[model samples]
Target: MDETTIQLLCPECTKDWQASPDDLPTPADMFHCPNCHASRRTSEFMRTDRDLQTLKQLG
Candidate 1:
């Protein structure tokens, strides 16, 4: 089976990180960017075509 994962992007720094959805304890949980220390909800991250391509390559 394939593990479900999510990609997180920081609007402030444009940095990104990826992890399993389980890492988020709740729907309201906020993700902090390692690069910029800015935080935002997972839903707020923009999923661009490049991000989709990266996910495909990783998969």
Candidate 2:
């Protein structure tokens, strides 16, 4: 799959952050920062895999 970049904002702190495609979890999967215990939906932060596939084809 093609790599995509993503920027995410913390819902609780409004913290701005960025993560590459490799950093994301699977859909509906929980993400917790070991240091902050920050959690979020994988889909909330990255583009859908199907959408990425479409982008790859378009390009």
Candidate 3:
């Protein structure tokens, strides 16, 4: 089976990671980086436009 995940980045700390779309909050919601605790809009953390779209569709 294939799995879909959202690629995330922390602009404040430059941390990167992946997470299931279902596990994340809405794209407009505040999201904190697990590594730096830097908080920002979830959409800002998305690695690409596609990633942001996926989150909007499945998050």
Q: Give the top-scoring candidate (TM-score).
A: 3
What residue runs in model 3 are displaced by over 4 Å at the alpha carbon? none
Alpha carbon lDDT of each predicted model: 0.59, 0.53, 0.92
Superposed Cα deviation of residue 29, candidate 1 (Å): 2.9
Candidate 3, residues 1-59: lDDT per residue as tens digits?
Answer: 88999999899999999999988999989989999999999999999999999998887
TM-scores for every predicted model: 0.57, 0.53, 0.95
- Which candidate has the highest lDDT of all? 3
Of 1 and 3, the candidate ahead on lDDT is 3
| Ranking, TM-score, top scorer first | 3, 1, 2
Q: How many residue pairs clash in each candidate?
A: 0, 0, 0
TM-score of 1: 0.57
Q: lDDT tens digits, residues 1-59, model 2?
A: 95655655555555556566455565468766444567776454333456434333432
Model 1: lDDT to the true structure: 0.59
- Candidate 2, run of 10 with poorest lDDT: 50-59
